[model samples]
Target: MLCRNCLRATRAAASRPAIPLLRAGISSVTRSATYTTSTQASVRHTLQTRLPALPTFRTYSTSSSESAAPPPEKPDYLNEAESTIWDRLVAEFEPTELVVQDISGGCGSMYGIEICSPKFAGKRMLAQQRMVNTCLGDLMTNWHGAQLKTRAP
Candidate 1:
């Protein structure tokens, strides 16, 4: 025997109006309404109304207005004291390759250093780093942070 609830639901559905669907010169098929959920509509509205306009970026121009002056013969970041850090490393380790960068916007507060030296050959990574820190000595007090890379040549 058919369920009474199912029979009632079928009768109610038959009495309801049928929805129209988009047709490509063919028989129609039912489709859902176009309205979006509240969350989706809100996200779309925020993206359209609340977001700021995109910024315009310009490329470096070598025109006469822009000074082509040979980059000041040295980096503008390192002051005399900062430069001395690399100089001292060179004096003590005689590194094969050395690169030292003042990464604190020229304030001489932080450094990133890379050095390859025979002096570090037998040492563990921590020991090598300690050696460098020990060499910095008093200068370490003024530095905010340091990223050091050391290798045996």
Candidate 2:
């Protein structure tokens, strides 16, 4: 009984708020930025292409061959405490490279030890570190903390 134009007029009822239709052509949005000296409302990262490239199948390196530089000689310039820890690690692991530093300034309370040894060659990283900690014995207790890095030769 109803005409086509009459049916279309009843569809948009009065209770609902009308949603404006979005037309095309906006290519970018303008953002309000604040000074670095003042508090910022939000921080956004806009650089997309500068990120590390997607990895190839089963390959991680960006280069053809990774020829690493040889490590430095066992440093003789270490203070007495650093040398003692270095000596113990050298004897136990027979490390190809070792660097020990007193990271707690002049206090000798904390150490940073990086050791690369053939003993670590076949082991997982966590196991190699556990081995180093075990070998350090009571030396582990005397320090407030240590930044220990162990790797296979």
Candidate 3:
């Protein structure tokens, strides 16, 4: 069965005959035909004409003037502390990618991470999350809190 809202929407849509504009796509044309429906009356509208095709996207060669910069190197302290923990966990359970985002305010201590790992494969959502928490272990004692997004590789 169709929902009441859906039926009302369909009736409203049918009542208005969408007028197409050449500048944009079907969406713009449809939006141009929009009208308010009164609670007291129910009536259908009809489209006056067919809409024109959507405008094609233009591509510019910005690369000709601009060059891509190399990614910044991971700092030594990051390698020593956070990277050490990551390396240990990755050694035990390899991952396709592990992203650590430090949100520790001015002091720079706490962090949030997004880990995409094959180790999480075949595991339930809660189990995957728990694995990350377990891997952090005692190190998390110093952290404010962590937000983790773990997905199967």
Candidate 4:
């Protein structure tokens, strides 16, 4: 079954003759009128006559000439303990990416740490994590537990 729009297009094409070229060709002697749907014509008419008549828009693009966004600054929301841990890790690793969160209801007893650093390039996963833990040093003694993740950048 033809959709509402397809039905309309088929009807429109049937009622109006196709626009002939400037001059009939020799082949026109034996030519027959094949069926055509005016869906493209209807879409073009809609865009030309209706959409641009309104003030909002006519076209859009997925590209831009602008540069990429700047890097994120250190978070302002961290508490004292979280800040301390962030500083210690930053100094030791010079990481490309780092995140430290207190997952223990804001009491700062348990933390989740993720770090990516060039210093971890030749290390295994266990060794990378060990480096982070060793950098934390005496501070880890105060924590009940930690969830640590490390990656080579």
Against the true structure, what is every candidate's RMSD?
A: 17.6, 16.2, 11.5, 13.4
lDDT of 1 by residue, 26-93 (tens): 23433233323453344345545745677999997677445422211234666687679877887777
Task: Summarize candidate 4's per-residue lDDT along 52-153 as a digit string, tens digits.
Answer: 354776676554334323223569998899989988888788777888899999887899998888789999999998998898979999999999988986
Score every model by TM-score.
Answer: 0.48, 0.52, 0.46, 0.53
Off by over 4 Å in 2: 1-73
Model 3: runs farther than 4 Å from truth?
1-79, 106-108
Q: How many backbone clashes does candidate 2 have?
A: 0
lDDT of candidate 2 over 19-131, digit per residue (tens)? 33222322242222322312111111222233456777885565423444343466878999988888788778877788899999879889999989878988999999999
The predicted structure with the larger lDDT, 1 or 2, is 1
Candidate 1 has an lDDT of: 0.69
lDDT minimum window of 10 residues, candidate 3: 39-48
Ranked candidates (TM-score, high to low): 4, 2, 1, 3
Worst 10 residues of 4 by lDDT: 23-32
Query: Which candidate model has the greater TM-score, 1 or 2?
Result: 2
Candidate 4 or 3, higher TM-score: 4
Candidate 4 residue 147 Cα shift, in angstroms, is 0.5
Ranking by lDDT: 4, 1, 2, 3
Error of 4 at 71 (Å): 8.7
- Shift in Å, residue 107, candidate 1: 0.9
Better of 2 and 3 by lDDT: 2
Candidate with best lDDT: 4
Among all windows of 10 consecutive residues in model 2, the one with the lowest summed lDDT is 37-46
Candidate closest to the true structure, highest TM-score: 4
